[model samples]
Target chain A: MGLPPKRGDLILYSVLAVIFLASCAASGLLLFTARGGSDLVLEAVLDGKVVESVDMKSLKDESTIEIRAGGGINVLAAGPGGVKMISADCRGGDCLRMPAIDSNGDVIVCLPHRLIVRVRSRGPAKASPIDSMTY
Target chain B: MNEESSRGTMIRGPRKIGMIAVLSIVGVIGIFLIDTMDGARTVTRDGVAMNTVVSVTLVSAKPKPQLNAILDEIFALIGELDKKFSMWNEDSPLSEINRNAGISPSAADGDLYSVLETARRVAMLTDGAYDPTIGSVTRIWRDGTGEGRLPSSEDIASALPLVGCEGLKLTSGGEAYLERRGANIDLGGIAKGYALWSIRRLLREKGVGSALVNMGGDILAVGDGDGDRPWRIGIQSPSKDRGTPLCAVRAANTSIVTAGVYERRWEMEGREWTHIYDPSTGFPIEGDLLSATVISADPAEGDALSTAFMVIGPARSLDLLRILPGVDAIFVLDSDERGMEVLATPGVRDSLEMFDDEYRLTFVDVY
Candidate 1:
């Protein structure tokens, strides 16, 4: 029972259809690029700054990064799947006792050395609403 | 054809306007979605202060530089607080107070006074089970732990006389002093909690609605985390392997503190001595409980209570907790009969998710 469409209405429809297609194209491109080359990386942060990062994907044999900062020394060993604090001269030796970090969100901190060894994603950060452990 | 043309003109104006409105709304929504996905980012910063690792995680829509600045401010705040509270830092106000103990009242800042006030309140509530003046005994233990030997009974006895909260006098005008020359105050039990409480306030002042502040293993959750879910905080297991999670508790806008014998302990002569010293006994707490996790609005209170629970044992802790509102506790004890047992206050029984199968969880109904 409606009236027939006019020229202006056709123009509006054409504009909307173009925008929808463009949006789809852009989203598709984003997805493809975002998923292409993400690899895990191990980062060593000292005093809130990232001092070093090693691509975990390329890691083979164990490599140690000895950092002497914040009035102490820490040795970080990185292997295929993860990184661990092999040794630290901190008073409590708590850092050496910490478990190896195998995936993202795992962290090993040496308070005396002011060092943090963690795993991070090389790609864009994804939101993890999961956890914060309280000891 | 003529009739159809005339009707089309009559309705075409309203129909075109409606189409324009709908398209406009869709375009706006699309832009908003893009903005949210692109602009919102989670920023995390970590540093070491107060003899512990401090981590702050926040969700912000600000630019990179601004977010960095905010984090810088937080870390700086922690550093400043460290200088005020650290026992090892000789230039700290607390050290100055210790130096002037029994000789003269040391002028204190508002923050120091406030923390001491809380410490005093908790000391009274626990009836000397947890006292800030235990510094005398703590120092002996600290020295012993470093030297890889146990303090002699004579040393412990001499230090025990100095470990009394009654000697700690705090004036209302922001001054504090120990009544005896050798008496000392150690804020180790509650310092991290107070730091977290201060950090939470600072984050709110900086317009940060959501954050997770972790000092060592003590945590303060501000608002809902990403995805609008209450933050899941793992309660560390009281075992030889530290950082192992026994359970996870959902938290929002509150502080979680866990005091465990495993945190700071040393083995000598086939005996284990922990850091939770009893002011009356001048020795590590020898109780059924292994660790105590406290959930409260005030981190300092939770901190002190967790230590107090370790000293007073689970039976007395339950009695006190029954009357204390807005405070929940989880006690892990090695029962003589049961291998491992976990007990939680009524409030936390539901939010707790057990991760370790070896421990049994039970609810203590205060109601």
Candidate 2:
């Protein structure tokens, strides 16, 4: 049989329980509210190399730019809504098939010619670093 | 009896104090673990090298300055690799090899030799479907694309004899030679993959536990993303105006590479030509496959196999992939109904999630 707990022991246990709960609440709040910043930057990468980065805020005019790598060429259009591949000489037309990317972490990839266009948040948008990217 | 109980209480006092101390230490460690696990930060760095934007994202406990310095070193290494491997640069080792074609075996640097050895091994494995010796043919297509004209049959025929990988010989001592006078070697198909593998090794050596090295579309993933989640990779759609992924796969510590016919293409005489050449025909491979994406532990294997699969088309490539161990693939083939047929190996099929309902997905069992 065990002896009855003392008042001092009860107070210490209660203090630790409260602290644990408080930390849990704090971490929960931090995790939920972490993805707040929304500033987006569009990046154009050809064959794994970044060629151009355009701020979404500065895209006042729709512009078409041609990116040529080896024998492949991709024509990209940047506008107020988002950036997209307008046309490409590659036979698959995969880049042209990709939707316009406006939000962070959305990407359009042309695998044959190794072109990638992606939208990324200007600031530290999320906690995890990039672990992998699909072309 | 009262005096005896008092003496016993005195003895228990120090034992009680020791128990309390141990509990406090446990509590503190618990708190520390929670804080460190929740506080993991992701640092990202990007730079232009190898004619593409190279980006590295790492999850680290280190300060930003230290992380940035490591990234700077990686970028510098990539730049040096680009200088060494780029065929366009006249001073590059690869260009020198091309310039010295048929004359003598050029002594290759460690990096060059490693890439060439991998390329040669892959060439042999794929039965020359993925030849690095197609430089002569690639040059013709590059010049043709620049001029917006197709290479004539005469030109293609002349380059055909020069397109065989058998013409290039590499010694175990890091020397490379082209056996034929007109034969040229291009590492374009496999160079980026080799660079990514090297970068991943460098990061590992630098004590980085997790990272992603994406050179264009050739990707090497090291560890889990933030929050212990597997990395999500989206496969590009081959259809028209279908923005959103055809599919996505979750991966960690793997390399993903895609070779498609959609990126580099030129129109000549009302026909479209891509950069990938068939060594046997000395022309761009024509088939239903729009792109081939391969996943493997080795980045160079993923890179070389992606190109080889693109050349061999879907059916033959799937056959090849079935017999090959440690690799899986997804082939996006052009369909008659304006959509695509997504064929994947069982391993790849398990992780793939189809985002678009319009496309067809077929799972193949090659085992």
Candidate 3:
């Protein structure tokens, strides 16, 4: 007959299995969440060639728009918290990633996109997605 | 490497127990890796090239460093094919042969051999429904520097004598000869599809778990989309803007080739003409179909089949459909007395997820 394991041995195996399974589960969850992120490059240009581009596929979907910029260029959008970028020309990769602007009345300028970012905010009285779709 | 298991089960010997636990963990982890590696990535050989893609699952789990590399190789193979086969490429071997008409060509590689082989095969299957030797006839009605005008009956008659598939002789040494001085081979109908086929092979070799290669509308899906979802590719509705897709279908390692009059055509003598010509009369065929699409295992076959549909027109296309064993087709035509109709093979209808319009497939020989 195989030798019986001590209580300590049993406890050790139980702990290891818990650790192994937890790590696996955590990693899988992170992967599933990350996969939903989109990676798309949106380029706005006046000519056939690209004037400026922003990579915003990963940001959360917003109902209101956000816009940002530094100089001659600007971006504009509306709805649930839209996002835009600020400043560029291959200067700092800034016009590329810029930052998230959530409030209304904030203006963003980019010398590169030839764009002006305009944001419009909605009050809490606004309907949610379910109500809007039904109406 | 020491055999720690030699010792009897030790009581409170912390180091000994720790060793057993560590070894067990390592062994189990090893088992997991060995079990999963085969499903991780796959590579394939396409014609003379190789393509590799990590498992579709890995595309998310790991970096896809070689995906673009695989696509680049596919493009390279197609470019090579184009250099060899394009009638437009004056430097091609086939062009050289065309320039030296009435002489047997020396055996050679590149586009010349491919063109000859494809022409011979298409002739037998389509019963000369598709022929590469219609070059002279096509030129009589072609508008190069000026508007395209109808060739006189005499000119057409002169060109017709040089245009039959039965009129050319292909020797085993890769030589093609025209029974008459004026005949030439034009693989325009089939070259793009062949290029797509080569590209498909390149993708297959790269272990690309799944891929979709689109050259203006000739598309091939190398495998199922990365995961369980089929790759949903849209077919452009005719006469619409490029961004507007009429419909979509899921592809699982299949090719779709579409031939249309609108893709490339010319106007001459205040009249419009297309490159798809009828060898019997040597002129652009008037038909119900504005376009025809075919599904096949490879691009070249799909391309040639799509051309056959275009050549056969609506009625003959339907008849050809009945003659074909398992192939399918989709035909779009003008819907009014204005000369528009949409037609598709019965087999194609079975695979159709959705379509809008009164479409039918009938067997007739309009050509």
Candidate 4:
């Protein structure tokens, strides 16, 4: 039917398949990785002054909060296994993109906005989503 | 004969209706895509953007603003807008525009006209207290680097001649011109307020109930959050003392702006070189306390007035405030010797719930 349903369809299918394969491998790799947990403190500073700080070890599941300074803001998130930025006002969202930190010694930072996402476990960190998965 | 022909042609009503419905749905989707992709773009403000928890964007509303992203956007917009529209940026189209002045209309886009007009109006109302065309004065006393030094009396005097509201002109047809070559209208004095006005227009058109534009100390409050309780905005204490708040102001439908010497200044030769300049003398204001807060129906106007009062000083600020209507101010004069003496309009004092004995809160009410 009209040149066997167009060559474009075949190309789309192939591209999608490649993406699926890559994502599966990556997710598997992440899940299977070892989980390292520790205690971490995130301090948001402005003009070399610490405006706000949050201790991740004390948090159980998730905590969403906002802090404001002269011309900037720092957002924090703390979760059960580990803590990471769900969002921030900083220019680059690198802090948010720092992988799910299940370990205590991980630090996710946004330098431009003076933000830090630090993770530390009181005991030992559990296996992360990436750590648990295997290819 | 026409009736008979029409009667015979009248057929497939359901099919026509079905086709029309499909077309309508497709048209709606097309309009949505076009507007979302291009009509509404993510625009940031230039200069020192605020780290704000203000959840004001209607399109991206959750709760407790995602801080860093808004700051970045604000910062980027200011930078981008500056690069695009700076009259002094020599490399900018706006510089070419300023060069042309009376020769061209500065583009039909109207941003130049809007910013210039807003600046001029604010300058006039403040009686030279807040003059936008004081860039030359600010440039002379440049104090960022190692060689940062305050300009001499002659330097200020020369620039003072070039500084005034008279040098900025906006024609009736949305065309703006720099009346003088050295004269410049820095939106820095009025940009936040312009943004507040534009955002308010967008919100009203979209039927949004409440919004807050927090450009650091410059904040514009519109309506209510969740349709209940006024927005409790905190005025940062200009005190060097840590972990203490000056006071909080509650607003349902108004904009509040504060201009402080502590905001951005480099002390040189026992004098503070700040961005806010006094057109009368073409110099940074010397003051007692920390900041001057302006509350008004127009946020942009409020912003301009705040800077004007900061430059004029408190004693002279009283004379200037009286002639102005629907505008009030709170001057926190650093009473370092006598402590902090707050000179506020009756309205501004009423808003603060004073706590602790040492820190006094006052209100300035302008109806």
**TM-score leader:** 1
> Which residues of candidate 1, in runs, are more than 4 Å off?
A1-38, A71-73, A79-81, A89-92, A123-130, B1-40, B240-243
* Model 2 Cα lDDT, one tens digit per residue, B280-334: 8888888788889999998987898899999888788878876788798988887
Per-residue error for B24 in candidate 4, Å, reads 34
Q: lDDT per residue, candidate 4, B161-234, as tens digits? A: 77777766667876666666665555567766666666676566545455556654567676753233456666
User: Model 3, stretches more than 4 Å misplaced?
Assistant: A1-135, B1-63, B138-157, B204-209, B335-341, B355-367
Best-to-worst order by DockQ is 1, 2, 3, 4
Predicted structure with the largest lDDT when compared to the true one: 1
The CA lDDT of each predicted structure is 0.82, 0.77, 0.56, 0.58
Predicted structure 3, TM vs. truth: 0.61
lDDT of model 2, residue B338: 44
Give per-residue CA lDDT, model 1, range B1-367, as digits (tens). Answer: 6999888778877767687768766875675466446745677887777777778888777665777898898888878887898777789999989989879999889888899999989999999888988898889887986788888899999988887777889887889998889777899988988988888888888888878888888999988765446788988888735556898899988999999888756678898778788888888888678889999999999999999999998889999888899999999999788669999988987789998899998898875
- Give the B-chain TM-score of model 4: 0.72
Which whole-number lDDT from 0 to 100 does residue A91 have in model 3?
Answer: 39
How high is the lDDT of residue B316 in model 2?
Answer: 84
Residue B68, candidate 1: Cα error in Å is 2.5
Native interface contacts kept by each candidate, as a fraction: 0.59, 0.32, 0.01, 0.00
Q: How do the residues B1-367 of candidate 3 rate in per-residue lDDT, one tens digit apiece?
A: 2355444434335665688678767765655554344243322211111111101111222233465356446656665676777665699876776666676554547456666777668766776767877777766665432342467888888888887777767777767766667677777777777776666665556555565555546776766664545655555566653323444455667877777786546566787777688777777877667887776675776777777778887667667667665566667777567354455555544445433343343423322
Considering only N, C-alpha and C atoms within 3 Å, which residue pairs clash in candidate 1? none
Each candidate's DockQ score against the native complex? 0.44, 0.21, 0.05, 0.04
How far does residue B338 in candidate 2 sit from its true spot (Å)?
Answer: 12
Candidate 4 achieves a global lDDT of 0.58
